[model samples]
Target: MKRKAPSNPVTQTQKQLSLEDDKVKALFNQKIWDPKFQDELKDEIANAKPYNWGTIHDLVDDDLLRAVRKEIETEIHFTKKETDIYKVNQSGDLANLSGLDWNDLSRLPNMYKLRQILYSEKYRDFFGYVTGAGKLSASKTDMSVNTYTKGCHLLTHDDVIGSRRISFILYLPDPDRKWKSHYGGGLRLFPSIKENIPYTDPCAKLVPQFNQIAFFKVQPGFSFHDVEEVRVDKHRLSIQGWYHIPQKGEDGYIPGEEEAWIDQNISTLAQLESRTLQDFEFPNAEREILPFHQTKHYERLLTGEEDNNKDCKFLSEALKLTEREIQYLSQYISPEHLTAEGITKLQKSFEDNSSLQIESFLNDPKSDLLKKLIKHDELNKECPMEAKDVKAPWKTATPSHKWRYLYMDGKSHEYFATEEDMLENLNNEEPSNFKWLKETLINAKTSNNDNELEIALVDLAQFLKSLIFKKYIATLTLLCPLAEKVIIRRFRPGKDFTLATKCNLSEVLKGVEGFVDAVLEATLCLTPSNGWTSGEVGGYELYMADETIDEEEKDDTQYERDVEDATVYRRDDAGDSVLINKPASWNSLNLVLRDESVMEFVKYISWGAESSRWDVRIQWDVKSMESDV
Candidate 1:
């Protein structure tokens, strides 16, 4: 059943005013770039546990935001995802959506301006700087505006789509006071204990204030941010945007610079990441067959009107072979004769053994889906996973992959592999990462009639996912229905451990737990062969009383010696030795491990923050004053 959106996200002038008042006057004049705010930003960024979310208080320009909002209300068309409502305006897809000719920008002036502004070099530079992305290509930007309504809030998601280097949102609320806390429509930032799994409680909140912006690097696991429910009657006005690889010579980006960047960042587990692959569509309209189409073609074109077995493409081909070899050809090549072992997974197609109908497109394996994938493989093109791909990418799919595809469309999820499995695979590298296991299972899947195929597929997914986490004692993965690269991580105890690769952690963790007496061996990858040049360096000492005072460097601003049992450590590279009261916090961490794999996995774990926000959060307060009633 199609779901209904919970609430509207469109913010009006009147309601937006209610979100803020003169009471938060301090917050209004709050410096967007002040040091104190920076600390809070850092704290929110570091302590950002998974599932917690954050939104920009002022991520983008207010005038442009208002312009976009006007366009969305006046000219844009919207649709539904179960119950959620969305309005999209992509430059390239404008023709399709508006059914207008794309010859001139003057025709759609506002959309043209939006496209121009988003792709402007100025915007690109600002985006790249804020994201610490260096220089970005203007052509990569696919800017759009999204309007949400009752139940319109997007569920837990990572905006790490294909080739999107960074993702951001610019909130447009009232010109007056702030967007208050109680009305609910606040943006939340989550911290990661591990990928995919989010912790409760927000790392930071934007109380629906006007003209604010929030942004983060599209770190799949860590950048797990979300929109709050629009509790009352209101709509949120926001501009969604991305920064892409510099186009050609736009930023002096060489042809392979983007790929090289990805290669330098990705993890092996990402290599096995599932992606938005095309589904299958019946090709009854075509005369030719498909590439994966194992069915044999007729010797000479059968032009006659009344041919028997016209229902089956394989039978028609067999009719031309003469009667002597008809039965033999039918045994292997005909759909009827495709003993559950043929190219197509007939068993999955006929689970009930009642209705048996193969998609006609398989008759033309050279159909759109296969052909497009082949072209992509050849060009090494990283197709945009933007929702816009739906306009052109899914038309030629067949019934088999289509069945799987539909599940993705409706559910936006798929089961995939994890980093921990890959870490284990790296440890067991004689066989090269479940290659044989996956092949055997796929082979078993050929006989779809066997229920074991589903189980085998699941096993294959898990095996592929494990390659993501190298340090975790355990790890888990969840692919968005059709989106394969955006895998979420769920670390299982002992299966995985994440050292902040973004931050130099060699300075910390010494005395905390493992490093009290001697040096600690952390599992973070730092091999020259693995792209990281910084080698392993760690040390720690148990929490102890300060005995010797460095009179030369006696600074009053040092940490208070509140407790004597805190662990302290000087890391070889990960910064200074600070006392840590909580060692268990280091025991488990949330971040994707990097590798030379799918690049998506690399992005999934990469760090994206204005500054680090580190903290040891205690969810439940210990009531030392009162006992259990």
Candidate 2:
């Protein structure tokens, strides 16, 4: 039997472009290069929230699909996995299941027609012309077709498979009774964190209707979503593909481009709470990373809330939603506070901190729990920086990675995950300015030397970690921001501890002349938020009397000598101040003097300095906090 034809779903209002049309080039120029129009579209995109949710019924006509399948059937390979199962008709220049080199559909007529139609001058004019922007890639032509059968499903996963800016699914179901939402084959959409990152939940969904088209931008994590299970006994036919940059007539195309594109949109490693390095790197590489829900709709359901009502609008008079609720809607609400009081507290919190208003009807004593939560937050810091984070997400090291460390041989070092990425960049082709960085940094330092060293770090990642911890503390410090509230609690090596306690703010920072002196004595720089430290990754170090780390250490000296040798230095040769250096040491710490190297290839070194050390007063003890208020 022959496949049914895809009805002409193209509307008169919708502009159509033919591959053979000359208007193609004109459309490309006017849409992407038009300065004024481009600017406007950019602004719109910037303000647009994360988005995705689409389906197309007439993507391929019957004659087209049948003819195309016949031509490429020998070329298709179906790889099915538990979570998702699909038959691949065509991939880019990558290898197929045959373990052999394959020709791109450059010679196929129907395939060529597909490409021309997608990138046609008229199509560019109508779509690109409106979007006012397009990705210029070395190899952008990528298309794939798949078939979903009984019990076969593709779970939630942001279609962030490649350098995909947009995702479209052209369905070819039997032209009969509606491709009802119950038939099980429907498209889902998700809201993104900020248009780039996929979230853990889906905010939208859609079942395919014959001759219909659905499309959306590719939001990574925030746009997490998945297809619904096929509930009926029927096969769903769809041509799912992406709009890639023009490969034009060129040779070299990197296969990892898709993965790299996705990586580029992800947050810093620190934000992700990922690895410190690699498998052999710090923090155990064996430690599990964040769960990959891929698509958010299902995972969010697991959290109890089945849906965001997809398209259901809030009834303003029935139960008005405050502005804060709207804002929080964009954020991932921590599941711990899911009670009625929690909801009220969250609503009230918006009222207090934001211009959000809560309807009188929703207020109840049940909100007391959230109020207590806020109070608790006001009383103490909630999130502390665990030493384990040195190997946690964003900072966790991968395997044998050390490209970043070899790029620099500077002094006191603090390593973060971003720095490690430099090592994985060795495959860079064409002209690159960072190529020499890896080699240059490796030569810059001889760990055994006593020269002024520079620490090559992923400053952003370090800064984010510091920010998270600080913000949490600030949330708790609703009590007050004190500059130097020195709690002189003694830690008898393995016995005592210093904890955050109620202390007077004015008393700590008020005209205290010795505070600065003492802090400078203990560390080098501070972050300077209400006198609290902020970005002090490569923390302050007090070199030795030799103005170098090599200064002789009298670790077992009598109390008198210990005090004398533990002095902080402010001159040419400084010694270790607070912490001690490990033996493997910053000596072999690697770095990239330039930004051209693959960061993951280097081993990061930490600045561990030690003097004739003697424990002193505990000062910097901070953490993150959250409150319903």
- The Cα RMSD of model 2 versus the native structure comes to 29.3
- In the range 222-246, model 1's lDDT, one tens digit per residue, is 4655565554445665565666666
Superposed by TM-score, candidate 1 places the C-alpha of residue 400 at a distance from the truth, in angstroms, of: 29
* TM-scores of all predicted structures: 0.34, 0.32
lDDT of each candidate versus the true structure = 0.32, 0.31
Per-residue lDDT of candidate 2, residues 1-629 (tens digit): 32232222333322332344553343223334456755665566445444423333344344655555554444545443220011112233321111111144433555445445554444544343334335433224334555555543443345444355665565655655577766766665545324323332345567765435455565544444455556556766555555544343433235665456655754222122333212223222121111225324212321223323331232111123335543332232232333446556644553353212112211223223323332343234222122232221112212111111111111112333332342333232122112233334346657552122111222211221232222222222221112211111101111111111111122233352211111111111111112111211111121111222232442211211111110111121113421121111111111101111111110011111111111111122211111211
